[model samples]
Target chain A: MAIRQLSVFLENKKGSLSEITNLLAEAKVDLRSMCIAETSNYGIVRIIANDPAKALEILIASGFAAQIRPVTAFAVPDQPGGLAQVLEILEENGINIEYMYALVTTIADKAYAVMRTDDEEKTEAVLAKNNIELLDEKNV
Target chain B: MENRKYYQPEFETMPVEDIKKLQSEKLIKQVKHVYENVPFYRARMDEKGVKPEDIKGIEDLYKLPFVEKSDLRDNYPYGMLAKPLADCVRIQSTSGTTGKRVIAYYTQYDIDLWEDCCARALVAAGADKEDVVQVSYGYGLFTGGPGLNGGSHKVGCLTLPMSSGNTERQLQFMTDLKATVLCCTPSYAAYLGESLKEMGYTPETIPLKAGIFGAEPWTSENRRQLEATLGIKAYDIYGLTEISGPGVSFECAEQGGMHINEDHFVAEIINPETGEPLPEGEKGELVFTCLDKEAFPMLRYRTRDICVLSRKPCSCGRTFIRMSKPMGRSDDMMIIRGVNVFPSQIEAVLLKEGYTPNYQIKLSRVNNNDTFDVFVELPPEQFDDSVKSISAKEASLRDAMRNMLGIGPAIHLVPPKTITRSEGKAVRIIDERKLHD
Candidate 1:
């Protein structure tokens, strides 16, 4: 299944990530997984949160450029090569992942990985065919 | 192209006394024209307790309050117009890299005189009707392309309005049309030169006889490289969008300094600190007063180009006063930790340290403190993306920059070609502090 994620544009200055996280915490929004892609001047912080709309509102109100994007989230075994198994499915299916991040659920004891791809529908179908367990907003 | 030294010989070779006489008459008239028409200029003049009568000749240029870049921004679109909107035929503007683009209006007459200046520049570069001129300066709100395009036609050259980019097509035209004169920024000219060699064409294979480069500050060593690479006489043309672009002054065969068009625009050098006019041959901020323009005539506008001026006689027989190549701009100086820094100084350090000149400076304000960082591109052979390797390179560059800039800068070692290439003006600085605006 697909989960909503927040992508915030932040300048490459100290405490920028902290500012975003602190803003989210102030809004009582719990983050699922986070990853950052950066260049020389600025960075894009991609984060899956429990309430994507609330998190995005907090960031935008704080003068940050933030947007919500649907990302595929799936759970794998909490062991080595857990990512390789899911990645092999996409690779064999000719699905390209733009970026991805992973985190292990404390209660479920299963590692969860969030992925953004060019073809979201294809990525979802391929992951399902590989017998991967997907997570929706409720599961997250 | 057959050699044609001067376009309008009378304007080009006018005696110093005659040039001054023409300038004085135009200055007195322009001052009155701006005061009566432009409310912005009138208010500024009124605020300074000065009148049009106070300005008689170029000597009184110092009495007028200086017009800074902010004035144009404050007055946005048509606030600075000195002519009726109906009479204005064209407009050119700045790139608005830092802030809003400053739009400059031009009447038909204004465009004519501007083109005349460019034609004169073309003649100085040995362009004639027999030549094929390929103008590569980016055309649009930018003044480089249109200014030279008109000039090329006025000179009766077979004009190729190629504008900028599309290197493959540019080379195709250059070879097919046998363009004898090239007009573009020095950076793009260098890229063309590099591409030509990569395509297996040597200087001997190229038919270019001359090139006119401007818009961005370039080094003397760069001029030499362009000359050697393209097998052409590289000339420097100076102008700003505020005061009729790309033909305000031009280098002739002498190549010592650019000869300012004293008839169309009056030139003055003033101490950046005190705004007092300096004697000829003293380095200071270059200022200008539009004498011939009918629309958007700026009076005593501070150009911020750091350079010197002289009236030395030239082998080209033009008696117009010449301006030394601009060293850097006073406005371009960055204040970091109470220390003044210029990006050119950093560029000099990078060049000396055997690195490509591709670099970017990012200034940000975090936690109420200014953070200055220089992102330099590493050549392919030396590029190491690892933390330890990049940190080491950054350390070395920081030390060198600290020695040159007095205050140390946080250096970021980026991979080669990460910094964007500029076609019009190379954007070397990005102040993130302005992001809020």
Candidate 2:
């Protein structure tokens, strides 16, 4: 099973990243994994944290103009076709992936893949029924 | 009406010999007073092996070393005061935005001379006793406020001492007072003009006849916008706090250029690099010699403003030498990637493209190399199309900047009114390279 994630809009300017991190730091939220999808002007800061609800609240209070959307994360074998299997399942479930990127992992032979899809719940069911493992704090 | 006639003469029409003789007399007295009273001046003159008696006329001014803004800063609060502290009736200082504030001392006589200069500038700009003048320059340590206040009073205009910052109140006062002439920075004038339009007030109903703008170097594009928006003739008033605020010179109704107050202050263009004087009509550094100032007499003070001087008689019948609008400061020139770039050059490019000149340049170092980025505020009309228009505008700006600055800068177009709008001085450049840990 995969856990839901959120994508936040970040302005690409000085002190922007520090401002967001400071907000999350104040809220006592630890980011498990994060990545920045950046263009020249603005960026989308996606993060998987210990507490998503609290992170969303802190972001809103800081006037970040962010949005909470469900993204699927899958833990797979760090071998060939590990990510391929997960994408094939999502394709069969009629789900379109806008973008996806990998997260850092502690285990040498295992990695987690984060993906943005059309339907989070449907994608979560497909991954669970297909025996695809979703990585959480305990798994890491 | 009788008082108005006393103030209406064109000083430029006077013979060059008469102006030269007047300047020489004033220069001799000013040099003697500074040498005797101001310790800094006395010490500097002694070190140079020059005496007050050596400076017989304006031609001998080269004997003095040029004073600069840093010299004023070194003196700080009271070291530069030529008169005793008790005799000093007024004091003004620079904003100290870059470093320590430079405080200027003025006695009753100094104040009177400053007002006279401003009054001369106003008279040259076609202001008369019947004109209701609204002064919107920032007051206090900043010279723009009090300088114009005294000048307008001397010109016998019904002066409105509305110092800058509050635009809404300024508009209300302008409309209510039916002010015929306004004094302020050119940028503020444009902002006020835009605000008035937003409030549904047409330019014709504003009752403004003319404006005198200065304190910062503004381009002709800004002047045209201010003139069009206010539906009034906009004139450039040139002066620095070091020289005595916005009354050192002014443009006439013909709008050719600003005429220096040759009788009170001697203007010279000098090669900035070589420190040698340049001929008229050539662009170089401006150095002013205060001929009549008593309390704080500055001799050949080097003003880093890069401009050209022309001695041709203006259409307004003033024979005073005219200085073009300054292009950039010699000190403020930014050398990026071996190419010299100026903020004013970027300003010209943006204004030509129909964008607000409200932008900030951020210079940083990445990968051990210099990087430049421009953050600009998008206009309201382009807000809805921000995502699409900003990208296109960014591409165009990158190309334009490359052509002008010789380097392509990453342009970031933000939403409307996002950048801070300063009521006083606008901060347009940020060099992050200096902030390295």
DockQ scores for all predicted structures? 0.04, 0.07
lDDT of 1 by residue, B116-157 (tens): 999999999999999999999878877889999999999999
List TM-score (chain A only) for every prediction.
0.88, 0.83
RMSD of each: 12.5, 14.7
Best by DockQ: 2
Best by TM-score: 1
Clashes of each: 0, 1
> Tens digits of per-residue lDDT for model 2 on B1-437?
44342243545566678888888898889988888888899999999999999999988888887787768868877767777888878877653222355577788888988888788777766688888999998677778889888988988899998887777899888999899888987657777888888898787887898888876555667677777888988888888767776778778777887888887789999999988888888989999988876667678888788889988877767677888877767787564532346677788778877788979898875532458888876654443212443578789988987766556888987644456657866678887653211
Candidate 2 has an lDDT of 0.75
Best by lDDT: 1
